[model samples]
Target chain A: MNETATQTVVRLDRVGKTYGSGESAVHAVEDVSLELEPGKFFILMGPSGSGKTTLLMLMGCLLRPTSGVVYLFDRKVSGLGEAELPRVRRDNVGFIFQGFNLFPALTALENVEATLNLKGLRGEAARAKARDLLGHIGLAKRLHHLPEDLSGGEKQRVAVARALAGNPPIILADEPTGQLDSKTGRLIVEVLKDLAHNEGRLIFMVSHDTRILGLADRIFTIDDGHLKD
Target chain B: MVSIARKNLFHDKVRLAVALAGITFAVVLITVQVGVYLAFLANASVLIDHTEADIWITAHGLENFDFGRAFSEKKLYEVEEVPGVLWAEKYFLAFGYWKTPTGSQETVQMIGFDPETLVGAPWDIVRGNPQDVKYFNSIFYDEAETNRLGDVPIGGETEINNHRVRVVGITRGAKSFIQSPYIFTSFKNALNLSYVSKGNTVYILVKVAPGASVEAVKQRLKETVKDVDVYTSREFSKKTRDYWMINTGTGVALLSIALMGVVIGTVIVANTIYTSTTEHLKEYGTLKAVGASNWHLYKIILEQAVINSVLGFGLGMFVSYWVIQVMKRGNLQVLLPWPILAGVYVTTLLMCLGSSLLSIYKVTKIDPALVFKS
Candidate 1:
């Protein structure tokens, strides 16, 4: 993906994120800079404790950088207040977690509709949209099933549908296939790859799964808070 | 948003039941305690509440009707001479002992009034008639006191203060809080049984003329009758109730128990809400990651608290209604007025909302970044 031709959805400029202070202070991410453009599957690959999740969080605008600037679609969000950060994330960014963090009490369709509700969509319109998103993720028959009733792969698919409910320009996923079997993990990666290529959405994911590396357009490795291309 | 809140609350039926139980227990405890206290106050002034007199003249420094000395009967003559005083009668009240058939003695409050005018007489006679007291040694006994008074049948004789008295009538719903059975008789017979000398009375019952002001009549009697206290019926009733409730520590004790019920309810509700919030902390983090604001989270929790409060309060009131009915059957007056019920409902709602504060604080502080970790 050429940066000059395509639009840049996420950019991190020499960002540093530190946790705690004094003797116990830990630098989670240091001097990490990157730009992600639309229509590409970008992967942040690292071992455990390599700060991949922290970098993803930083790029997702869920965490503030201790140094340098972070921008989402040319808007600097690293310095935004608590109230403003959520608006930027909700309007432009969608997230998927490794645990498939669906509300156990809500059904799959209701879980997807929750995101639409957060976006101020309501009534039958939101329900129809949620149904379509679940159907697109191959979970049309499982829409009314709860997280506890669905298999792990089905739960991850519901999470995918929920993340896509808002139709944001960028999707940030952290080890979304970590809890699935190899066959299911590959299928999940295929769906995400198709979303980036066909839907023209920027996709950023962090994982240690080498088996899925062939599917990424670009890969960046992080170790001990340092990034390497 | 409300659907999510409803689902979360109904998901765990056992937890929901436990939470409702705690709230119901609190409501019943507080309501019953307050009900009993109100009933006690009502009973303390039962006579003053039911009497037909407009004014009462008692000896000076009389705190209540129970413990007061008899004043000279001549005060009634002076009170009758006051303007607006239509008529007046000497009434007698004194504590005396009655010997039961089993050789056990029971305390009795001997009330004496004019048999001709029937002023200050028992109005709830279940058997016989008020005029029957005109016979010598004739008296009326409360039906509720049949057990303590040895089931004295109508037209039966009993020994009161070593003076033989015949029970010619039975009264209903006239039980006193002091646990002393009331014996109604003629003024002469009461004086004889109480061992009081002739020409003295404990209270002077006065009636005001039609369209006349009771307060004005009370003032006139106070001025004309020297060294005696004059009070309108309402004023005396309040004074009597206050004397027993506030000065005697009964009000404070019952009120403290009721307040304790509120405190216990609040704590139980708060603990339950906090636990539920903690259990769902991860889901909240996911919601934040999916773009839910702090306000959205707050609305969900507030809805949960409100739903619990309404349902639990309804159940509590139902239980309290049954408890009050049981008490009534036992001849214990439990007054559950509409105002008290409304006040308790509002307080219970507030208590449920107050309990959600801790949970709201915890939820609002959940880090959305945690969703990236797992």
Candidate 2:
């Protein structure tokens, strides 16, 4: 890798986030400092209750760092107001969850279109964007299918399409393939890898699959609220 | 945004159907009670309205409708002779109970009108005609009393207060006070039967000359007759209706019932919308995480609530007006006044908005980190 290409898109400095207070307080993320650069396929691995998820959320500007600073594109995030975070999430960051996934009631095309529509696109424009995303994700034919009708792989693909609908610069995906079998999980990883590779987007994911780790440009292991070297 | 809301409403049409059913049921009760009350008010003024006369000359006191009377029935001829008076008809009203041969007694309002003048008759007969008008001494009653008075053959006699009378014809839909049928008879027939003073009646109903205002005639009559009160048809009809509207406890009773319906509708809308959003809490979070601004998600959920409110309102109005086939601003009593309808819509919309705000809790407090490790 060229040293000049490691320019940081996301940076966390001495970030510590604690829930509760005093003796009973629990530190979810402690003194975590990391940099995620553009076009980097980064993986955060951890057991349950580890700070890995917290770190990604901090990078995505969803959660504020407790004691230090976080910067997205050189803009200070830890000091951002509550109202400002929504714009940050909408225009710059994308997220994927594991269990509570796509809005189950909306059709696949609607799910992708809803993201663009939320960003203030009109109905026709949003639909066009959503259809293009679905077509790119190989779900063009299943545009009208609801989540219940979609298999695990198809649902994840819809989720990915939804994430990219707004063309956010950073995609922060939770274990998007956690619920899928090995073959489907590999397919999801390939799609995400393509987004990072061809599109030059920063793709940060929390995954349990070590098989996909080989595809990551960088992988960090986290355990019990601390990063493991 | 609105389109999203409408599509979402269509998405779960079954749930929408269920919610709309609740609103419709409430409207049924509301319209029925309101319609019946208004129908009663309309029936109260039927005798005066059917007279189609311009001016009423009653005793100075004008205490109760049945007990009011002028000093003379001759006053009818005098009013007819007055300048600009086209004609005058003597009208009498009384309240008495009819004890049938079956020993069942019903209280009724008795109306006496002139057959020659054709001033007050069973004009709006639904089932029968006033062919009985030829029999001056016989009585014609509305059909509602037919069940009690028996299908009176034209020649059959019934004892009404120990006096023998011939039954003429059964009126179609005539009920005064909405409980008892009004009994219509000739001027002298009702006078002697109800023990009214000889050659004297309760009031004089006068029809003025063309291009004459009823209020002007009323002012002229009251000026000419010092010891009597003159009222226009609309004025006296409203007076009689107000008498019953206040005395019979209809205002408080129907208002309370309608208020309850509105409250119930608000609660149902609020709870249903709030619960629906609660179920979609995580879904909202996922949307927020995926390039959805707080306002954006809020617009969607709020659109859903407003859609529910509008749908419920449209259905409620339909069921309310369709039941009695009554128009809103017509003579019908189920008045959906502008304020009431507006209040309902505004409050319902607020309820929906308030409930959907609960879903914003999910959006704001949602830790995108919670689902990180899956």
A82-174 per-residue lDDT for model 1 (tens digits): 888778888878888898878888999999998899888898889999999999999999988989999988998998888887888888999
lDDT for each of the candidates?
0.87, 0.73
Positional deviation of B266 in candidate 1, in angstroms? Answer: 1.5
For model 2, the stretches where C-alpha displacement exceeds 4 angstroms are A1-7, A21-25, A123-125, A222-229, B1-14, B48-90, B96-107, B114-135, B138-175, B197-200, B203-239, B309-374
Best by DockQ: 1
Q: Which residue segments of model 1 deviate by more than 4 Å?
A: A1-6, A21-24, B82-86, B97-106, B123-128, B141-159, B162-172, B207-226
Per-model tally of clashing residue pairs: 0, 0
Q: Give the DockQ of candidate 1.
A: 0.57
Pairs that clash in candidate 2: none
Per-residue alpha-carbon lDDT of candidate 2 for residues B1-374, written as tens digits (9 for 90 to 100): 22545666676767677656655555555555665666667777777777788888887777445455546777766677667677887777766678676777767667777777667888766544464554745888876566655566666777666677787666755666545557888777778677667878788878889998777777777766667778888788888877777766775687678667656755666566666666666777777665566776677778887777677767877776676565423324343446656766675566556656666666566665544434
DockQ for every prediction shown:
0.57, 0.45
Evaluate candidate 1 and give its CAPRI docking class based on DockQ.
medium
